[model samples]
Target: KVPTWTFHFQRSKRQRDDDALVLPQNQKNPKASRIAYKIEEYNPLLDSSNITPKDWAKIGKDIENNYMDYDGFVILHGTDTMAYTASALSFMCEHLRKPVIITGSQVPIYDVQNDGIENLLVALLIAGTYDIPEVGLYFHDKLYRGNRVTKVDAESFGAFSSPNLAPLVSTGVNITVNWNIVWRDKYQQRFQVSTEMNQNVGLLRLFPGITATTVRAFLQPPIEGVILETYGSGNAPDKDKALLDALKEATDSGVIIVNCTQCLRGTVSLTYATGAALKKAGVLPGADMTPEAALTKLSYVLAKKDLTLEEKKWVLFKNLRGEMTDAAGEPKLCLSDSRFIQAIAKSLSLSCTEELGAVRDALTPSLACAAAKTGDIEALEALKQLGSHLFFGDYDGRTPLHVACCEGNLNAVQYLLSQGATVHAKDRYGATPLSNAVHFRHKEVVELLRETGAHLSRDELDEAGVELCSLAASGDLEGLKLWILAGADLTKPGPDGQNVLQVAQSAGQKEVVATFSSCS
Candidate 1:
């Protein structure tokens, strides 16, 4: 069991054996400064020392009944069953209007160097102040809604993450809230407590040789609901009729069986034969909903008094609290390695400018040129598949060669030069590849461009002044050195009326400033 507030309270009681244990004196509520608040100390469910689960429930009921007496409730519990408790209370507390932030630390609270104090303090602050009515788990300084969370790691300090969902609050020096992502139940405002959970809900994991006997046990008379975790995209063998029949019987008998994926990314649809078989067998596809969300939601719906069985089944598959996404008509973009499959798959490619880049007719020579221009090696490879000759011009009328030189892509510049690119090819502005190479301080590319007999006239030096000064202004020392060595007339003033050295000095390039000092 996880060490909680009771552990600390017990220790305090032991140290001061004579006096009745009292909580730290009341502190001012951080939310509405007018209100003063006191901590409500209670025994945790996992406290084998004195309290049982019933005792803990009684305490929870007391707080839920008399919630107006206090601003919020803070619970410290063992991490093992914290989710169960949080999920139970989410249904038990009906229209909750105040924060009931549950938190636990891996280390004991009494430890001098522990995360407990900070977590407790922050949870208390949020609970006492924020109008968060839903149950939430605060761990490692991040606040996540109780239902959407899973304990991903057991030993790490950062043990929990809401993978399919965004965290409600992220903590640094200040707790930054993603208010747009918070979950609110408009229908749940008028609080109603429903705690009767169908404990017979079966959680079945699909694995190799998962036979009739394995699934048969879960579909037995006792179980009322089932959360079936299926293989990629909710597929099961059509050959398995026994499992199919069992599911069909359960669903026909008013049992709610939800189908979720074992994978972290992607969702299931009733498109394929295998998925359709399960759907026909009365298994509802929980599109993109985590197993935790599905289980609790089923528990919630099963406990509701008003909804009929059909209504409950409909609600299970539909979006509630942003847990599941509505289906899109077209199949989702897949990244599977299967060629025989009719799935849509696209590779991720990033350009040098951090834009998501895509290639049209990816295996074409022209696509290679486009990739070279954007400095995307993957796209370049795809482009090479079509033909040897590849070339693309940017908006500036600069070819792949010009972009390569400017961006210091030595390999791309070399490849372009090797591919019969004219050494003296000038851009729309009449600036050659060597001019860009020198201006960008790509010495190696500049050397190669010069080896290809790249030329720049004395008149071109005047035009080069504007581009060279821009590089210098950005403290590009390498570009400045290349231009100076490549016969760029530093003595010439730029169109901006500032020389390279003046640009460097004004931009705080002390080394470039010193280098240009000698030239001036």
Candidate 2:
């Protein structure tokens, strides 16, 4: 049982008129007893578009003022920019340990067929009953992290969706709460609010034939941050030197430019030459973040006057408020040595020094690298806990990630990333994890590495061609295609001084032989 308060912004699309009170004040019914709750509404509502950073400050202040009075809060907002408001509130409200559910509907409660009533009812129920303390958007039948959600359909009942992350709760016959995925504070810190949000940010979308003049004009004075929406996988035209120069100039002027992909599903990857150019020009990768999250996050980050510009850029790429997926998974401990596994499970400190010594006596750097390549999460965790150095290179200068990428161990790759493995680490032959993933046709691993800002130079690509030729010999059409699309030189000879077609034929890869024959 919990006491509930509703703060209405009066931005519902279903409202017949723009009034302060959408419903009767302090209205309660028999349904209140069933849910074991009491409801109260506040005043001075405004449209969602009119809800700015100042208004966000007001909301935070109100919540802080009445922090102890209620267990949870619900905000009524407009769907037109509900995502923006939600994203803004997620950043503005800091260290919040109580649910702040924002909800609205396509139709008004007065309509014969309206969703507002249900949305409000469910939001109230979840706010009061559930222990979900983060800011969330309750729409259609799902509860999404406030900053992760985007309003997808203007006409459909399911108006919102969280593309990059899973929902906190899915409402069907039974309200299924995914406890594992829900964000929680382990230490239960006191709630705080951030009132200052810099609005001097803008978004520039790239398209075919977009000129340098347009880019330069948009990035002119007054804009401190810009979200540059690029083509698939965060690519722009490398041939467009003028566009690249304008970006470089903006970054040189201390403008924080974030390179995000226009594609909704995947993240912005810096694998291609064009994406590498953007990175060289100092554009930070906005990995899998929706434009709404990117824009609001940039505003929040820029508003932190205490932080340096470099620090702000660092925070921009990190996952804050469950807004974006940082990596796929955490490191798991899997070791044949029960003692080492137990030591890691007990604690990650030096108390396991004895067990670590035993393990280190048997585990060489190459063996540890083999464990990483084989996706031995437990072994990696144990090794890390035992204070094993991660930067040790194999004979070929390949790191654990390089081997994991070649083996297509996405979990190992993600776990390695979480442990601060360098993404752009190069081998003796200059092959990166991305190049290794490409060579092995590990599409998912390639994307993950790219999302982490791994890039290859033209020379590095040429060096990786030897590995790609192996894929061609094995009849790996997908790998061959990816390399071709990435402008790999197919004319290069393999180690045996034979072309890719000759290698394919010798390896009995008829399909690959036919593909090369047809191309020739």
Candidate 3:
């Protein structure tokens, strides 16, 4: 029952007229399709049509009419104006209840590996049957509310993301829905579109030694609002009276001046005296809102001429959807909820739900060194919660599985694995979970890990770094045999250019040395 439309606009011939035609390869061969629209190109955000306003209006009306008669709508739009179109649709389409999902791919439909098919398939699925409507955007396996999406990465296929908003849903082998977050307004939740945007909104990124003349021109009579990209978590130079005076003059003339941070995370607070000056001048903080979100939100709020200016301010400060968090923020605690742990568990191919607590419990070891050092089952559970924090300070580093294997904590080892730890994890030293256990003298831990088919030998460690050599010098015969049986590379030499047999000899363990010789 879902109604879908593919709105394709012809690229304008004039170079300067098509402001939305910001594709990467602009060159066009006279005979073939313009290189700009060649879908095989790397950056799909650039592959946008240079549609004129008249054409867009026509397309919008056509889709809107068709949408009223159908259950949901999926639009195949050019990447360039996608965000703008999303913002525009948030107001333009009236009483929209069913999904009005917009999507585009990095490559054209003609390419063999074109991402268009997946994007289209997902969009159709969302529009065709998915409940909880409101304008939305779906692309590269993630669904975002249309109002919150922004095109960030130009080169990658997953170019668009709603940084201010959590994804409505994500797709893999099975589509996962974040049911709690999806928006559903009960009263009068029907399609009601309006298209009265005040094009007077503008953005200004402050730079060193900016002149009053530049600020004054944009803020004067014509513009109704201006978004100032401020420094740090929203600080402007108090030292510069010219900038301050210009901002004051603009706010005095009834133009709304909004302050937002140039940083990705964190909110804008005018905590400093200098910051106080900007707020005194009537500048408001846009707390954690992305520039794109700020711009579109401003456009959306301004479009509703029905709301008073004060009401607009109130709406901007609070979250309309899941666009922004609080003015102050903290690190996302890995253990507070088992959802992420559950996701990690599913990814690691685990089956038990009752035992899933072990993984969530293990995350605590990542918080404090003592929590992990205690060697208690609770401590090990805490460590599992620490997740990636155990192996590396940043999220990109090793997970808790690395810490357990490195210390040879068998309980922690089993818990991490059962909870969906990646057995193939390598620390900065490139040592696998099995390798770390062997080197750390936890023979039982190594044997248990070996059952999971973890990589065990030198060839497997061809890129195995120097730090792992020190662990191998532990002269663990049982650990070494466990690895050897699991298809370890015999040709890989240690730092001293010694094979496993030579490493055992150098470690002065006769029993280990003999075992290595027999294995060969």
Winning candidate number (lDDT): 2
Off by over 4 Å in 1: 3-36, 43-60, 318-322, 325-520
- In the range 1-520, model 2's lDDT, one tens digit per residue, is 0112355221111232234333332234322212223334534566565667787787777777656444467877778788887898898887665678988888766789988888887787776556576889999989999988888898888999888888999887678776546764333234678889999999899999999999999988898999999999999999989989999999999999998888877888877898999999989999888898899999999999999988998898777777777667655333434574455545645435465554554454576689887899887777765555454466666788888988999998888776656554556565667777876778887776655545553346546557767887778888787676544667777677877777787889999887767654
Clashes of 3: 26
Q: What value of lDDT does candidate 2 attain over all alpha carbons?
A: 0.74
Error of 3 at 214 (Å): 1.3
Model 1 local distance difference test score: 0.63
Per-candidate clashes, comma-separated: 3, 5, 26
The digit string of per-residue lDDT tens for model 1 on 1-520 reads: 4544421121111123343333443344222232233434553335423433354455457655645334457777667666556655665665454567778876767878777778877776666444455678889979887766677777776767776667788887666766535544434133445546556676788897888776877788777788899988998887888878877877898888899988877788777899999999989988877676778778767766788888888777666555666565324222122231212122343333212112322323344556676677655543433222344344454566777777888877666655444444445565767777776677887777655545564346657788778878888766667876676767667887888788877888888777778788
| Model 1 / residue 275 / CA error / Å | 2.1
Tens digits of per-residue lDDT, candidate 3, 1-520, equal 1112453222222232233231233233342212111111222122345543333354456555544233355676777667666655654555443566788777777789788888876666555434535667888999888767777877688888776668888988777766545654323232344545566788998887778899988787778888899888788889889889999988877788889887766678878876788898889888777776677677667767889888877777766644566545434434435566667778876657535645644543344234333445575454434443332222324456666666777776665555434454444344556666766667677667656545442324454424334435786555555555444554466666867666666777777666556654
Candidate 2 vs candidate 3: which has greater TM-score? 2
Worst 10 residues of 3 by lDDT: 33-42
Error of 1 at 152 (Å): 1.1
Ranking by TM-score: 2, 1, 3
RMSD of each: 23.2, 27.7, 23.5
Question: For this target, which candidate reaches the highest TM-score against the unseen true structure?
Answer: 2
**lDDT-superior candidate, 1 or 2:** 2
Better of 1 and 3 by lDDT: 1
* Model 2, residue pairs in steric clash: 332-377, 332-378, 333-378, 334-378, 334-379
> TM-score, each model?
0.54, 0.59, 0.53
